[model samples]
Target chain A: MLKLPSVPGGAPPRPGTPAAEPASLKDNASEAAISALGWLDERTAISGTARWVMFRKVPKGTNWFYTLGTSTMMAFLSQVVTGVFLAMYYDPSPNNAYESMRHINNDVFLGQFVHGMHRWGATTMVVLIFLHMGRTFFFGAYKYPRELNWVIGVILVLLTMIMALTGYLLPWDQRSYWATAVGVNVFASAPIAGPYLGDFLRAGPEFGATTLSRFYAIHMLLLPGLIGGLIAAHLYLVIKHGTTAPPWIEAEIDEDLRKSEA
Target chain B: MPDTSKNTSPYTADRNIPGAFEGETVTRRRFMTGAAHATNGIAVGMIALPAIGFALGPNFKKLEERWEAVGRPDEFSPTEYISRTITVVAGAGETGKTTVYLRERNPDIDHEPEDEYNQYIAISTRCMHLGCPVRYVPASQRFICPCHGGVYDFLGEVQGGPPVRPLDRFYTRVKDGLVELGPRFSVNSELKRFSPRDPAQDLDALGQYLFPSRPTIRKIPGT
Candidate 1:
């Protein structure tokens, strides 16, 4: 019989050593949870995958600036939550738009507070994203293998601005009305397809019901979906490329270790 | 110095530091690369300009405030307040139907022919809190917003609830025996006085605390 290496606590018998009996659960709550995870791992390798993604080692010099990306994500999630709540009471019609906003501000439970949070959260996210981008640029984190991520970041910035613009008209207040009018007219000034594009956005020659509905759809649905995809791609690239180190520390590291693989 | 000779892998060792490569001077190549990037950036921006302009076209349009004729002077009663719906042309050719509360102020004082305009008090039916229409309650001599229970006395003063200021008033003019409504003036919450100028300009002291200014386009003569 082939003599296998001695197990830690099992007896190493002479030629006919039978395999040691499998260990049973320790009859404790913690042991039960561990055993349950072990059972899951046997089928799906869940623990291994979790360890690979969640517990992977980051570079030594990663600092507080690294948290900006997570902060932007948190801000986005807050927007989504607050937006959904507002959407519940929001009337996407020209007739009811102002009234519905009034209802939300005055009547809905914590409505004004949540609405304020969403508005401020959007502004915060925009600021945080730019700061995050600035950090990445200064640290030279967008070099070589992460160039695509930089491109994606630019796209994200544009998408965020679009999100803001589309949402600006939702309240249908005087400010929103005039602001949206000015915003759409800027699009109409484009050289060749400007008129067509303006018509498409406005849904008519003038600002009316269709314009409100279209902006509402774009703000609530289309932009969010596109941004959600971009965010996923951005995060995937971050994980694959690994977080970049600070410039000073990166200069000291070995060249081979410094250049992350694509 | 670290041993440079041992680090022979072209992909890993050469491209580690940004713009650093083996056997080439960094400055010239770096400049060329930067120029190329700048050129590409300009090209992308040029392409994006029209699309961005198209997206933000509404923002560029001029906002205009036009005086709309609501009703004749005789239609309003001297004894009680009456609510009348009038279409107001807002920015970009969009019209909003708003309620105007019309009542003859100081019915006891005989009005002179020229001062007929001063006899009428035209308060916006829209609540000061969030723009919900306030209904005039003759029983309690108050205007109440059904949406929020905000009470405004017959003069459009906020008697109770979350209204920061009294209801906004229309800049009214009596022309050809008709009440013509011009732009709205915002009321100072503390002073209880309406600022005749644009709210944005008048409430500069509040600094964005009051309603945002709806700047009307200053129409120039003959293009």
Candidate 2:
């Protein structure tokens, strides 16, 4: 990263803007500030174009309702950071899986907590994404042009679930074993290709070390990469769709009726 | 579909646009479409997730379990069976002290159950895949590994799973009234019958008799 020059006193770099004699420099700074603010302003307002859809300012205005998308993004970023840490200690093998995990708990500092957080946070992403989608749906946000974005969001959720499932097997212990067996059983219940699917997935007779390594790759790399792409697309769509009108529209209608009484 | 296009009234359908006439409904349509697709996309994405996970891994950790020894009897249990596991201390090998299970439960046969006049066939719990301990699963009637899903029966035969072959079984004999297991031996079977460490099929009769599983492709007689 190229570090920008800053005042020694610790401030944003304000080199040429003078206190009194400045004219063009002041104009330049003001122009820079105004343009920054203008970009923010342009992304708001109820009516926006496909060319540039203003999202924050809608008929309803930014309220508690607008936080869901940002919240989902926050959780995803947290996963990336914590997942990176967990990758440091997680061993992807079936035999020494439980022993390695125990070693992490007993030997490595803060390893247990990081592992727990990654485990629990993935679960929370499932919940939060559902809630976010629900919030978007009942509001009739996906009726027309937003359909593709809705699909992308769904893909994101599925990717997250895949990531979580793959992570589940990396521990390589008995719990990982049986859970995977149940998973394979579910797969075996699928249409015609069940048995072949199970064998192919396991890469052998049963879910063992080979299966663990495969899942670890998918969890730590494959699904996560897909998720990253989908999230980026999802955000792009969010910027395009803009916010929906709030429930307060009905409240406003009610307030107007009461105002006549007053 | 109820003639969706005709549902719009003529007044709404015809737009008098000279030059600057936007569809007006286009943004609304786009927004709604985007949301709809996102919702649908997520549903499909979520659906693929379980499928992807199962394909990637159907881990057996849950099916596996931990094995804990309740305790050994003062005397070897009658072994109408061929296999029995006895714990040997790291240092006790030199003393030739091994616990053996009697093949038949006979109270009147010879002294008490504690005497050193019995034989027990015992297999180690270690998994062949990673050397992790295997557990005795009576319900499944196989010695299952909690670490991996390796399965073994009473005869210490590795039935299936990732294990290369049957687990190592230590032959036990009571010598001088002290239950003593063998110096560690694995026996391969080509001929039928409960045979001891046969010199013919022994991979390492002197090293540590390790056995190999014979595939059914070439059916050798006896075993």
User: Estimated TM-score per prediction?
Assistant: 0.50, 0.46
Please give the TM-score that candidate 1 achieves against the real structure.
Answer: 0.50
Cα error of candidate 2 at position A43, Å:
21
Candidate 2 per-residue lDDT, tens place, A62-153, comes to 56756787787788888889889877776666545677788777888998888778778877888888888888887767667889988888
lDDT of 2 at A25: 65
Candidate 1 ranges with C-alpha deviation above 4 Å: A1-27, A39-43, A253-262, B1-223
Write candidate 1's Cα lDDT for B37-99 as tens digits: 999999999999987776666544543455777788788776678877666544323345667
Write the residue-wise lDDT of candidate 1 on A142-208 in tens digits: 9999999999999999989888889999989878876666576556444444444555677644466
lDDT of 2 by residue, B32-73 (tens): 999999999999999999887766443221122112232344
Which CAPRI quality tier does the interface of model 1 achieve?
incorrect
Error of 2 at B134 (Å): 15
